[model samples]
Target chain A: MDATTVTTWMREIETSVTQERDRLVQLDAAIGDGDHGTNMTRGFAAVVQALSQDQEAPPGRLLILAGRTLVSSVGGASGPLWGSALRSGGRVLGDQATFDGPQLVEVLAAALASVKDLGAASVGDKTMVDALEPAVAALGRTVGEGASLADALEAAAAAAEAGMRSTIPLQARKGRASYLGERSIGHQDPGATSTALMIRALQRAAAASS
Target chain B: MAIQTKPRKFLNDPADVVKESLAGLAAAHGDLLRYDRAAQIIVCKDAPRAGKVALVSGGGSGHEPLHGGFVGRGMLDAACPGEVFTSPVPDQMLAATKAVDGGAGVVHIVKNYTGDVLNFKMAAEDAADDGIRVASVVIDDDVAVQDSLYTAGRRGVGATVLAEKIAGAAAEKGASLDKVADTVKRVNERARSFGVALSSCVPPASGKPIFELPEGEIELGIGIHGEPGRRRAALGSASEVVDVMVEAVISDLKARAGSQVLAFVNGMGGTPQLELYLLYGEVDRKLRAAGVVPVRNLVGSYITSLEMAGASLTVLQLDDELTELWDAPVHTPALRWGV
Candidate 1:
């Protein structure tokens, strides 16, 4: 995958978040402030605007720009969570014009760690980590098995979707929802849902390139 | 599926609520405040008074009279208002910090929410890069939840108002940024708050309650954002509710017999001032029975949610310095004394 593929991923995320805007807001409304949808939509729109202004940037630079935009535009916990992830991943990618299979997997691992560090949340906390950690691990496993980049992303997206669904039965251990305690058990995590959306966007972008 | 009842709010477009609120604030209190639409910051007209430490505090917009209303002489130098229930971005804070920084430097009075803390940390770093000295004190006095979505520890609630007043007074006295910060930290340590929500508040943008409370039920330990409380219990009489809120706060603060404290009974926007005064009476009675003296008291809607029908009680054990600062002249829209 190259810079165009990366840009495609960002574009796809913008579209997907826009389409799922109400759903994400409803999910957050169940346990949060109900602005996740609005915040994510605004953040992605800003990302697209920033990216468009500098279309010829390297893949790493594009992701970094998107991350910074999210951090500044989205004014909630999700801003830092998603922003630090992409920023750390972009830093590791370090001006790479192209993201090969191993480099993509490396970015996923680094991004996951960065988000976890910023949020202090881990898997089973019923946050974005519920989706993100699994997707990263699935992608790592698939790539290690010699799968193509598209196949690995597809597998990761599937894992993320499953992880998002799995949040339905777990009580939240972090975020505003945790204040609900046992009452938070039945709702899907909005952060995890958005994470799944991003993973699916990545998979679609990779397949489009193939 | 049943039809959902959308909350009724008086406003134009939700998008323009924050902008218009600032406009109204600026219009009403132009003598005290100057609003910068581009920067979304409310600045004291007399900010950056030479050689005085400047104080800045802000959060999401719904908690009105909080950050913005507290901006003036002997209080906050500036307030950065974010979208409702969302943290202000770094740019807003950076601008406020820079615009208000006197030669004595600027101090950020940040609430303990994750978003606010992260954004303020970023702004402080950004200001440092610009050669503006910045220090910060994080207020985490809500003892209801140990850690919640936006906080790693206690949530900053009522004490934020008190901290701003006391610290703002310290700054006005020409204290160094470090000294002002130390005073703010001490204020935070000496304060504790607990809140109960009789109903949920709907942000203008969401157009729905953040959470649902069954009829005749109350959410105890509720945060200012209308976030879920520590527990949901059957609604009780005003005295009962005040008992629960005051007792929990006292226990959390370990208030023993003969402890002199400043008690604040804060209205959560929708609640009437009459009810807040009633609640304050109950709180005062309980503290006296527990051998705690209510030395100074503030009863009103200073820090509030947007039309959330609830109240929070804050207990601040005060020393001589804190009491003196609290009594210091403060001229602001929401709070005033010794003017």
Candidate 2:
């Protein structure tokens, strides 16, 4: 992906987070501190603003800047978790002006590892990892098969959506929702849902770029 | 049971609530502390003292007079307040850490919330990167839920006040950073808290109660932010609520007979002084009867959830060192006794 395409994806995520703010809020209210929506909205808005200021930056630098901005502006579990993910992914790209599908999967792998490391969550823990790991695995598999980037992202987004929906039935075993134990079982994880939104934004940006 | 149903708070703008409050705080207590508007930190006027380990603690903003009001002599060196229920950013924390670094080192007292833990983790790393010796003591001493190796574990509650006080005293007395951290860890290990909410709390941004609690029902085992709670149950008398809270706390703490304990009864914002005192009375009686001797007791709205009518009970089994630390003079805006 190119710098402009990455920037478009960030804006797309910001728009998606804004539109789904209340839903995320409601989901968090049931099992958490009820600020996930506001936090994501604020974080993505800052990401967009940061990307705009450094329009000449390469895709790698833009990703790093966006991650740093989120870490500084968001001020929540999501802030450091998402910030580190983006920064780690950006580091894999390493100021490269453009990268192909295989490198994109590497970026996804880097993000997944960052989040898992910081959050200490696994696939069944009902966190952002649920949506993220599956999407990354799907993207890795599809891209490895020599598929186009758009098709790979489409599969990734679909996998993320499925993962997002899957969270509805699982009990939260990490984050604030974990404190609720069984009560956290029925509610959709706000973090997972937001992850799905972000993955879809990547797909949309790639599709539009093509 | 007619009551005030109006949703109201004295705020100029929802966005500037924390900033405006800090402004007023600085104006009123300029002698003790200063509000760093640019960095969003509430710091002691006498910070960065050459020979003392500085203490820094903070979390969401609504828990007023908690991280902020406690910044003064013999207590916290700095407090970082975030927006409403959100945690303070790492940049803010890093600024506070750097501003208060006294060459002796710094200790961050973090409550065990995901956001607070995550943000402080970043700040601690950055501080170390900048060559500032820093350590963090994470407090998670709530008995309202079961804590396991997995999950976020228990929510930190009323005992945080005790940890801050005792740890701050240790830091002020020329103790090394490790010793002070150990002191705070002791408090965390011995302290257990349980809270109950009579009504839900409204965030300034949302302007509505975050959760629904029908009248005559109590959201027991609630956290400072009023997260749905451990569970909801029928409302009972103040004395009954105190019994439940005391029972849960002492049981979780496993306070054995003939052991001396420090009792603290805290208000959850909207609760009146009259009610808090009454609950303390019940707590005193209950503890004494159960052989958990109450030695030092504090009663007030120290840590709070804004406008949420409720109360929390915290018990700390005290030894001589902790007792001495607790009795140490602390001077601050909201809580100060001995000079």
All candidates: DockQ: 0.53, 0.74
Best by DockQ: 2
Give candidates' CA RMSD values in order. 1.9, 2.6
Docking quality level of the chain pair in candidate 1 = medium
Instruction: Please give each candidate's TM-score.
Output: 0.96, 0.97
Location of the lowest summed lDDT over 10 successive residues in candidate 2 chain A: A25-34
Model 2: lDDT equals 0.90
Q: Assign candidate 2 its CAPRI class.
A: medium
lDDT of 1 by residue, B1-339 (tens): 347665587688878899899999999999998999999999999876888999999898899898999898899999999889889898899999988987789999999877888888888999999999999899999888765453357789999999999998998887888999999999999999999998888888867778788999999988888777878899999989988987898888987679889999999999998888888889999988877899999999888889899999999998899999999999999998898
Q: Per-residue lDDT for A1-210 in model 1, tens only?
A: 788887899999999999998899889888777889988998999998899899788988888998999888887888877888898888878887887888898888999999888778888889999999999999999999999887888899999999999999998887777766777889999999999999999999989987
Report the TM-score of the second chain of model 2 against its true counterpart.
Answer: 0.97
Per-candidate clashes, comma-separated: 3, 0
Tens digits of per-residue lDDT for model 2, B1-339? 235344587877777988999999999999999999999999899888987999999899998889899999989999999988889999999999998998999999999998899999999999999999998999998887789865688888887899999999998889999999899899999999999999878888766678888988998888898687778899999889988998899888987898999999999998999999999999999999888999999999999998889999999999999999999999999879899
The i-RMS of candidate 1 is 2.9
